[model samples]
Target: MNKNWSAFNIVSVVFGFTFLYLPIVLLIVYSFNASKLVTVWGGFSTHWYSEMLSNQGLMDAAWVTARVGLLSATVATVLGTLAALTLVRHTRFRGRTLFTGMVYAPLVMPEVITGLSLLLLFVSIGFERGFWTVSLAHITFSMCFVAVVVQSRLVSYDMSLEEAAQDLGCTPFEAFYKITLPVILPAVIAGWMLAFTLSLDDLVIASFTSGPGATTLPMKIFSQVRLGVTPEINAVCTVLIGFVATGVIIASLINKRRMVNNARTDADI
Candidate 1:
């Protein structure tokens, strides 16, 4: 196949990326604007960044979002990994179709339906809507995302590696931990990051499940945005973007380094 870049391909790539990223670029630019008006540029300044320090509500919401994202992502990663393993490795279980359907249903379900269902479940169980409830809702939805991510990697995975470890007298659990887990660690990490991002950016489910004093960053941002867009909101979004980008870059670098080291070790052997 010819790999030469065609004129149409070049135009499409340029148009697609600009369409996707131009809004984010503008938002980041506006975050540093000295003007109170989001659209009008008085001058570039970091005043809003400084002002964010004194915003107690934003700080509190940030703390809650961070905690919820971390906890939900961790729990979701564990549950999703196990679910993926069960689906991939044990194909003969009873109700396998039902289980797979349940795992996938949430992915296509609307946010409003998921939120309402969770709210009703909590209410019926007499579980108060609050921080824990919000976390639980996040975990419930995010695990499916993790499962999807890990399951894709598992599909192309070499099962012979795990079987070899088991044949060497390793227990089932030991084989999985020693061989399967290491090979799929990249996918697991990717799933956790995706779950964390979803939890952090979620608003509808959090709104339904959260109570007093459990407001997340997305909830707080939505409340403020309903009133009007402001430079402060832009600033907050910029910070969130920066944090996520930094994390992704760091993870990529770490994974690349690990791969290089592993390659070197294999060459030595």
Candidate 2:
């Protein structure tokens, strides 16, 4: 098997990454533009960043987004972890196939359809569409993603550890808390992060579900974008990219450290 990278391979790799990130790089660079116009750069400055901080609408949207993301992610993680356990630990239950299908259907379902359906359901229920409605909608879609992530991890898990814990007189809950939960914590965290990102980035679902005074950051950005791309939008996007990148890096480092510690403990045993 050939292991060396050809010139063509190197070019392809570079081109792919450039194509993916060049726009982001340009946006970040232009966020510092002194000019109000995005394309016409008038020297590097932090004017947009300053202006963004002072924009009350943007700040309120950011708060709403943060709240929705946190609430939805936390709830989705719990529900998803439970669903994964139900599918993995409990075998041959009635209606299992139906439940599994429902859990997975959202993954391939169109966002427009999901959003519209959710909106209709809420309207039928006479539920007021606002922050809670948006959060509920987010949880509905994000939970499936979390379930899929945790399910993948659960499939490869060793069941013997839990059985041994039970044999040592641990109750079912205790066994899960001490043995099974720790082993699958990484997947759970990954699911939470995925859910949070989805909730944070979703515009379509949020737009459909959200009501007056509950605008999300993405929705706010979309409204502004309709007028035209401004340096302010560029600054907001840059900040969002930075925040997400930092979170992913930190989570990765924590997971890596946990894995290393687990490996060391196993070696010592």
Steric collisions counted per model: 0, 0
TM-score of 2: 0.97
TM-score of each: 0.95, 0.97
Instruction: Write candidate 2's Cα lDDT for 53-118 as tens digits.
Output: 999999999999999999999999999999999888877899999999999999999999999999
**How well is each residue in 54-165 modelled by candidate 1, as lDDT tens digits?**
9999999999999999999999999999999988988998999999999999999999899999999999999988899999999999999999999999999999998999
Candidate 2 C-alpha error for residue 48, in Å: 0.5
Query: Residue 144 in candidate 1 has what lDDT?
Result: 95
Error of 1 at 22 (Å): 1.2
Query: Candidate 2, after superposition: displacement of residue 105 in Å?
Result: 0.5
* Residue 182 shift from truth in candidate 1, angstroms: 0.9
Provide the overall lDDT of each model, using Cα atoms, as 2-decimal numbers. Answer: 0.95, 0.95
- Best TM-score among the predictions, by candidate number: 2
